[model samples]
Target chain A: MKESFSQSMDWLHTWAGLLFGWLLFAIFFTGTLSVFDQEITRWMQPELHRVTPAPLDLDAASRTLNQLAPHADRWVITLPYDRKPVGAIGWQHDGLSTLKAIDSRTGTVIPRRETRGGDFFFRFHYQLLLDQPGIWIVGVSAMAMLAVLVTGIVIHHRIFKDFFTFRPSASFHRSWLDAHNVTGVLVFPFHVMITFTGLVIFWAIYMPAGIQTRYEGDMNAFWAEAELFFEREPANQPAPLVSLADLEREARNHWKDGQTRSIVVEHPGDRHALVHMYRRSDDRLSLDSGRVTFDGAGGALRAVWLNENPAYLTQSVLTGLHFVRFGGSPMRWLYFGMGLAASAMIATGLVLWVVKRQGRHAGADAVGYRLVEGLNVAAVAGLLVATATFFWANRLLLPDLEARDLWELRIFFAAWSLCLGHALLHEFLRDGASLKIWTTQLVLAALLFGLLPILNAFTTESHLFVTLPQGQWHLAAVDLTTLMGGLVLGWTAWRLHHPVRTSARSCHTQPVSSSSGSIGSS
Target chain B: MSLAAFLLSYGGLFALCLAMPKHYRAMCGANALPPRPVLLMTRIAGWLILGLSFVASVDAVGWAFGPVQWVGYLAMSGLVLVFGLPYSPRLVLLLGILAFLAVPLTIILI
Candidate 1:
């Protein structure tokens, strides 16, 4: 009660930021990578890299689905898009469902590697690859992020005065603070919008009181109203289904040349079969591109659901904002840059915590200080290595190995655990110095990322040399971006190797005094 | 048109940064703030160009997406200016000037 509001906010900012900063970094980093998820998936699947632009082979795809599951209850086909020029078909037979990737140009199944592809990063961004618990944890971290952003804004009183300020020539602690402030303020709008929308995207799960009260905990009912979704029981009477291409053409016409992203033939063999066509979200800011439903048996129009309700539109717009599904490649790049800035802001804040205390704790080696240092090294540098390792695993694993995707995930965690172990070992072997751990892991990450193009060249024909000349930007971007990432990491390690001059006086003069760590300092 | 919008945003942010006395000092190598009229002109022009960028972005896309893009461009340009200021102040200023020049060049091409 005695502390001023700003001081109280500072305390909250420091502690909350430290506690959840690592998790937030992972979320933001992966979320940034997820912006180019499709492109990354394209890079990972060599089978799709050399795909020729061709019209959707719906007849062939449909025939394949029928052959695969003749008595299936429903059939679904996802059409090829610019980012991923491959079609996927799935059907449910009895209680089992089968899905396969097909070359849309050839209408033949391609045995693509069993990898989660870029969806791994997207899923990890939100759920950490865990199920419900991961979602809840992410929700909590998001809330913490919101609080940290608010408190950060509150504590930094000279927001406008330091609007364009970044002093890289300053001392380590000072420069780190400047980096954090610069990133935080420069893209403040994006930071706020992204976090708020991230929460909004999962508002139902995070705050289910509305569904619990209004829909009696039936999520399906809530979504039915929220999304204007409808369903009907399958009539057992057998009926011939209409052509998918015809329905798709109709939907495209109805949407005025809008591209159909996916089509689902529900109860394909039943009299009441419904064909639903989803319009792509490429041209619109809202992810809800509106759906057209037809009577599958006769191909007659049944329902065209274009969300016009203000609340639903707003929700979809917010979700769209979070998903970054609109505005093409330029917009995706902008999101990617801003997302990296956000991650950088958190990274600087995490490093600043340790640097601010380094002066007093140089030889003290407090358990809390060491713990923070080790965790910071692993969470920051180690995680980078883990990401690079994931990419490496994708290439090195045997192509036809069973459950190969899970192996990639295991390799990622294993590499991350090793980094943590190395950091902890350093903590015990050599107290008050983590430079070796930082340098080693960073160099490893740098090598992994930098040599990725080379690894790709060896593993597949879709390397930079091949993709760059062929105008295959989706595949080329992955190689170029990773090379750039490696260069940046290597440069960072070089900077750490040759740090700026630091003196005892300069350390003492840092704004974040040792007393600030004590909540009662002010 | 989107390219023009981003350029205008970059130039506008540079002008805004130049309006600040400290940054002006950093860029212009002046120990003191600029005259009142010069500061006023820079600030007004900065905001005006930023407003133009909003218009250009809206023209490039549409109402639904224009404003979002404008914000993104502003943030990105601000970042370039902030990070570039400490190391390559002259290059940053030149880049801003190039952006302003290219806006007209892009318009000509269109």
Candidate 2:
């Protein structure tokens, strides 16, 4: 009975991991990149490169907004911070919203090129380029991942004993397993935390029972009550508005930490106008720190919400952990590294499934095996190629092209689809020569990433060498990371082409063990 | 300073791992495993070193952010150790020893 349980768990782990592995890989990869979303955005928008950090002048910003969008109902100004040194202003006119980067010193709108930048990856990870249904798909995949992790632990009895074991010199299947297990175990806690917290971050969307029960299916009412302390109703009365500078001063005096992250003004030209000053929570591990609001016309303190309740605080902390927006450079880099490791773990597991199956099946089953092999290559290596192409598109495409942002996204999907086609062609033509496909794709990625720094240098005035000495760490870090990525991918490609002789020998001669067989057959 | 603490923690863990019968043979290129006493002593020292690393990390970041940073360090250390062990055992051991030695230097400098 015990043996049967383990066997069943083994089966469950294998299929659970295999079925959603590709989607999980996409989520993990894009999610990892989203850690540096702002940095990537800054890199993509080169016109914002010249902008420097300075004290926000609300009067000047207001003047700019008035000149650009006088008739807008609402205006939001996001002040420059340490990571992003350029202010951004967004406004809604005729129910249409538009946002643009602003020079913090002059409060002039910086004419930057249109690109989705890191937000593409950020949104794609959750939304998968679709709308509401995409989120449910990602959530389902995450749930499958949770099941896989749990069942994996159950079947692998020697978790601790083999904790530090990674025998790259062992047989092919063994080495892949070792890589998977080592990466998984090394950051096991992170994986669990990330997965669980990711689910919680979308709790309201995934499980609407609480809100449905409490508010009788009225989400707006639920949100209004939940945020009752800061709720405001539009009076729709006509009156002249007070200066935002005065409201900011008043808000600064009210909050203990006087740093303001952003300023929001609603009904800008009306009597019931509201002004909100949100405190920066970058230094602390919380999502919503607090905000102070005032009557826009009279400039009187209206409401203050500090998020002191235990439930709210807990939710903020969980969101903070998932977002890592509170951390500085070192913390962000750490998160990035751990995320990469987690991605590698998923990639290796997916590859291991294909490899283990290939060993058991022979010539008659080779076609099906080859098809899986092609998909494994495309999903793993092809996605990376697509990401590289996205960066390349940002650099290569003309800034003034019509619908430029849409074109960039189109290029990304086109490149990715081409990769899928290439993989299929290779499978049919060469019987799924995985090594050849892997080497080619990796080398292509290496070249694409390796040249990004040079491209940035030629395309823009600021590159790694220039930015590093100028104390522009964010831009420099992006270039440095891309270069390192190129080097790593190049090395991996070289190694794949010419694997160590000892390991290759063992891979061919080693007998198929019972334990290895169970992973595939069970 | 946090980097140094990470190295020290990782070095200590790597040492304890090397003292394991399987890893010891793999590293030392020897047929016989190290005696039980050696393994026990290495394990104890490893725990102590890791505990000290935790303290160092706490001192660097405040109490509120310290534990979170420590977990990041642990994951990073594990990553370094895992990638290093398979490709080049000798290099990993040498780097681990160097990191262990540099902990005191880092402490003095900081």
Candidate 3:
């Protein structure tokens, strides 16, 4: 009975991993990149790369907004913080709202490139650029990931016996499987924590039955009650507003070291205007919990909202864990490393699925087999090519091009789709075990990433040579990481092109045939 | 302190690997497993050091972020061992010794 149970779990693990593995790879890869979204954004915008972080000047920002839109109703001031040292001001007038970057030291508006920046990777991580539908798709993929992880653990019979087992010099299938197991097992706790937290991040949207039943689907009213949100309608009587610095000081006093991330003035220049100061999430394990509301005209503290509900706080903490918003740089690097390992785990699993069938299913007539083979290449190597192209597009495209951000997105998708075509063509032209498709895509990615610093040197002043000497590690880190990534890719491509043969007879003691047989029989 | 925690976790994991017959044979160039008492000693030392790592992490950061950092440190140390054991067994063992030695050095220096 126990043997049968293990066999069934093996079948389930193989199928579920095969079905959603590609999507999960893309999700995990982009999510890994999203860990350093702010750094990437800094690297993309050359103008703000070296901005001296000065104290936020609210008065100058107010003057700029007043000059731009004297009759504006609402104004927002985004304070400068560590990762992004540029403040921004937006004002609404005549049904149009405009936002511009500002050097907080001078409070003068700066014209920066309008690329989507690292936010593209972040948004794509969860939404796949498909909005609501993409959320559902990613939700399903996360569920599949949970199931695959559980079943994988169950099928790994010698979990403790082979806890530190990894043989990179074994047969192709054996080595890939070992790589998959080592990465998955060594970081098993992180995988489980990250995946489970990811599921709960969108819990309200994914499982909204309670809210629908209790609150009749009135999300605003539900949030108002749950969050203890303070609100007031605009009093149209015109009145001069108090200094925002005073309100920020009051908020700091109340929270005792909490830094304000942004300030929003509702109905500015009115008697009933309200100013809301939100605390940054960088110092806490919960996102957007501490906020102070004030009377805009008098700078009187109206309300302080801190999350106190146990369930809500748990959800927030879980979300924070997945987002890695707290704990500074050491924690960020830890998450970045684990995130890459998770991506590698998924990529190796996908490759193992194809490699296990390589002996019997490497012909054009085996359409389904050939299809998976082609997709394995496209999903793994193709995504890297697309990511490299995205970075290159940031530097290659004209800074002032119309709809520049959308053009970057288009080029990214175009490169990915072209990679898929290349994979399919490469599959049709060969019969078995020819990895020219992988080699070609990886080589292209290597060039794009390895030469990014050179491209930056030609296009902007924030190249590695300049940034490294100036102590701009944020910009230099991107260039150096990409260069290292290029070297790894180039080495991988070389290995793929020049296949190494090692006999599986010397130390092959495990039951590799049993696992493959389960996949075949099922 | 996080570095100390990581080294402790690495040293602890290395001890656990040494307790296992396969890794011991591979890493120590031994044809047979050690005596029963030696294996038990190494296993106990592994768990004990790992527990100290948790304490060190909590002492450095507060209770809120400490355990989180501890988990990350453990995973990182395990990854280093997983790769290091197969590629460079001698270097991995040497690092494990240095990791254990650093604990007292840190306590005295800091």
Candidate 4:
């Protein structure tokens, strides 16, 4: 009975992993890149090259905001942090909002070329290129991943014994299995935490039954009561606004960490206008809950909201764990590396599904096998090539072209579709085309990533040489990471092309035929 | 500094894995497992090194932020060990030793 249960779990694990593996890989890949989102944003916008020391001039910032958005009903200023060195001002007029980067030193708008930058990848990770339904799809896939993890653990009874056992010199299928097992085991805690926290992050959307039952499906009322904050109704009586600099100073003085993250002025031209200053939360692992509000006309302190209930705090910490927003560069890099490992885990699992089947079928002309193999290449290598193409499009596209951001996104999809088409065509034309396609796509991705530094040097004023000496580590790191990614991909391609051939009699030899029989019989 | 600690932890884990019979024989070109005392010692030392690395991480980024950072370090270290073990055991061992030595040096220097 126990053996049968384990076999059932093995079946559950295999199907769950294979079904959502591609979507999970895409999510993991983009989510990993999102760790360096701000840095990517910076690299994309080279016009914001000069570093401006902080203690940002709010007086100048307010002046620029007033000039740029005089008729807007509300204005928001996002103060610069280490990653984002330029303050950003956002305004809403007639229900339309616009955001622009500002040089804190000169208080002038930085003419950054229009690019969605890192936000594209961050949003893409959660939304998956679709609109509302993409989120739910991602949520479902995440739940499937949770199942795979649990069942995978159940099936692999020798989890600890094989924790450090990675045999690359073993048979091809054995090596892939070992790689998948080791990656999955080593970061088991992280995988479970990340997936669980990821689900929790979208709890309001995914599990709305509680709110629906309690609040009669009135999300606004639930949020208002849960948040315990009141928004004042706007008075149409016209009045001149008080100096934003004074209100900012007042807000800073109230918080222990005197650093304000953003300032929001609502109904700026009315007597009931209110200004809110949000405190920075990077000093702690929890999300920012510090907010101070003032009457806009007199700059009088009105409300101070700093504390939250335990439930809210738990949610925030979970969000922080998934986001890694509170930590500095080293922490972010660590998250990025873990994310890549998780991606590799998913990729290997997908490949293992195909490889394990290949050995079972041997010489059979199975359409299902061909389809899965083609998809394995398209989902893994194809997605990578698509991402590199996105970066390339960012560099090569004309900066001032109309609807430039949309064009860049279009280019990304177009390239991705072409890759999928190529995979399908190759699979139909020739048997066992996946290996060839994988090698070719990997080499292509390597070239694109490897040449990105050169492209940046030619296209922009600030390249690695300039940014490195100027202490612009964010920009320099992007280039250095790209170069390293290229080298690694190139090496992987080379290794795949020329696999080592030791004698079949290794110390830990397990006959490939017997292994395939066991798998096939199961 | 945290990176150095991370490397040290990975090195320690790799050494401990090398002491395992299956991996040891596969990589070391040996027929017999290391002595029981050696395996026990490596296991204990491995846990100690990992614990020390955690302390180093906490030192770098306080108690509040340390665990998350440690999670990342553990993941990366595991990946490095997985990729490095089969192809270049010697280099992996050499780097592991250097990392083990650097832990104390990092503590003193930084």
In model 4, what are the clashing residue pairs, if there are any? none
User: Order of all candidates by DockQ, from best down to worst?
Assistant: 4, 3, 1, 2
Model 1: what is its DockQ? 0.54
lDDT of 4 at A42: 85
**Which regions of candidate 4 deviate over 4 angstroms?**
A359-365, A503-522, B1-4, B26-32
| Best candidate, DockQ | 4
Maximum-lDDT candidate: 1
Task: State candidate 4's DockQ.
Answer: 0.68
Report the lDDT tens digits of candidate 2 across residue range A1-522. 998999999998888888788889999999999999999998999887886578788878988987898668899999888777888899998888888887776778888899999999999988898878998999998898888888877877676787677665555677788778877777777888888888888888999999889889887886555554444556767777788887888788766864888998887767778888898887778777878888878888888877787887788878788888876878888888888888888889888878777656667687777777778878888888889989989988998888899899998888888888888898778766777888898898898888899998888888887898898888888889989999999998886676543432222223443242222221
lDDT of 3 by residue, A434-514 (tens): 366778898999988898888889999988779888888888889998999999899888866654444233232343432
DockQ of each: 0.54, 0.50, 0.56, 0.68
List model 4 lDDT by residue over B1-110, tens digit each. Answer: 67666876786687677777776775666566778899888878888778877887888878888777777787787778767766666666677777877777877887
Question: By DockQ, is 1 or 3 better?
Answer: 3
- Where is model 2 more than 4 Å wrong at Cα? A229-236, A362-368, A503-522, B29-33
- lDDT, candidate 2, residue A409? 92
Across residues B37-102, which tens digit of lDDT does each residue of candidate 2 receive? 988998888888888778877888776567777778887877677666666667777877888888
